[model samples]
Target: MDGRPMTFAKMLEETYTDGIAVLHRGKLIYERYFGALKPHKPHIGMSVTKSFTGVLAGILVTEGKIDPQAPVTDYVPELKASAFGDARVHEVMDMTTGLEYTEVYTDRNSHVWGLRRANGMAPIPPNYDGPTTIFDFLVAQKKQGEHGKAFAYKTVNTDVLAWICRRASGLTLSDLLSERIWTQIGAEEDAHYHVDRIGTESGGGGLSTTLRDLARFGETMRNHGRFNGRQIVPSSVVEDISRGGDPEKFKPAGYTTLPGASYRNQWWVTHNPHGAYMARGVHGQGIYVDPKAEMVIARYASHPVAGNAANDPVTLPAYMALAKALIAGG
Candidate 1:
């Protein structure tokens, strides 16, 4: 893929993809499993969970339970003294907040590790006096720069949005997801979100689901949030997300793998001719949807690296090539 032609199977192997399901016109066209994954086994979704949280927030917004233009403190007053004190809900949802927290995964001292420990994804030392809960961790964050200025891929913003969604809807993340999405998608198996010490779902990146279920969710988004003969998510929300955010805001992030791409409602918009976008996670997990080609690809993987930069170069080209082939043959 770097220069020469690469086969689809070679791309999968090179990216360490565990499972993938491709859908065309709401029908299963290709599916495969590898590594230790099975058709029904739930795989860690990583930051892909942020997209789910975003959709849930959109649902709440459509119901008039949330006001995105309002300050973050309007829903969670406790964060009024934190970095989010001067931020708006929409800034957090779009990850354009100027928080001091750092999310470099390879840096052990990065603030993301603190979040992982607080969210029950990492080991906490017995003498650790840092924030032990996600809420506490969020409240301790400090401001770095002006909010709503540029895009920064921080998991904490998604958690903050999830917290706002809970406050506005009077429902926990897991319960809300089950009631609004999981149950409505006709999922074959139950999905779960890893929780913090006080049973709060790690809405940032804690979701796990079967490959097929992931594909279903992708198809739902592809169809403008309708699936299983019902409107699972409002068409307006999907349309807004599909329309995308400011690429200028997304450019400073320096994601060389995704030029001219924007982050909207936790999804990555390609701004390409195919009107393609994706919900992506660390270590290669993703749901790539090409609207013009009527294609959706849901994948779970375990790459040695934790960033999508490694996976994008290999997988993204293959996806686009396949989309072009589908359109040409049709």
Candidate 2:
């Protein structure tokens, strides 16, 4: 550690992180555990799981098992009457679906919470008659704006994509991920997903894995979908995610924390010279990959704030600094 001490222990103490892992040039540079997190423990990935789902969809497309331009209704015909019925698989993958649901986490009655209830993460009321499953919740969504016109962050869109992955691959999300990604990449341990009553993986935000394994995934992406001597995911898939979607569409989303950032295939693109990208989750879960610098950072935290907006001020700068240090040292 020749650079200024950004040790994992110090990061945990300073950022209230549950776990932190850093990989530079595909080697573990630092790792630490805090607040009951263990090497084998699997903490919820939250929206970070969205990236996994997106990548899986990409793999399916590469294998000729799916077509991104196809209508989502082709896979989940039951959604034909819903807002997502006309949505393209690529639109959902890019989060350009124009759904009426709001993602305001501060509000108890927000549509995101309703999704949590439907996905079985939150307890439902006794007399609740809304959608009982994630699929149902998505099918019941109302159209708010035209699809493919703007970037709108909606969890239900990912859930619908997950369902498509399941239907297309003829396997559950967990099985598909394990077979296509986790095991192939030599994951340190088996990751698990929280399931609903009928055993549907939450898809939108329910997978969990240890910091080390998460770092491995980040490194895999940094390597353009190759890992552990295998092309676990097609290079084209990674290129699409790294290239990112239109910044103009992203501007309307109003992510003040990420100026000049774009979203594509469930990954957040910084569009900086280093070609940095990230998989982020609510409440401070992040996997930051800087391909030019050959650095990957996996962090899990239970920050007081629910959205990344609050943490980005400190985290974004810190990551850029760390990447610069790594590049200089190299």
Name the candidate that leads on TM-score. Answer: 1
Ten-residue region with minimum lDDT total, candidate 1: 1-10
Q: Over the stretch 1-330, how does candidate 2's per-residue lDDT look in tens digits? A: 224556534545666689888999899988888889999998889999999999999999998999999999999999999998788999999989888899999998999989988889889898988777786788799988899999988888889989999999999999999899998988878898988878899888999998899999999999998898888889999999999889999999899888899999899999988889999999899999998899999999998888988778667778888899898987
Clashing pairs in 1: none
- Count of backbone collisions in candidate 2: 0
Each candidate structure's count of clashing pairs:
0, 0
Give the least accurate 10-residue stretch of model 2, judged by summed lDDT.
Answer: 1-10
lDDT of 2 at 225: 89
Tens-place lDDT per residue, model 1, 90-141, is 9999999998999999998999999999999999988999999999999999
Off by over 4 Å in 1: none
RMSD of each: 0.7, 2.8
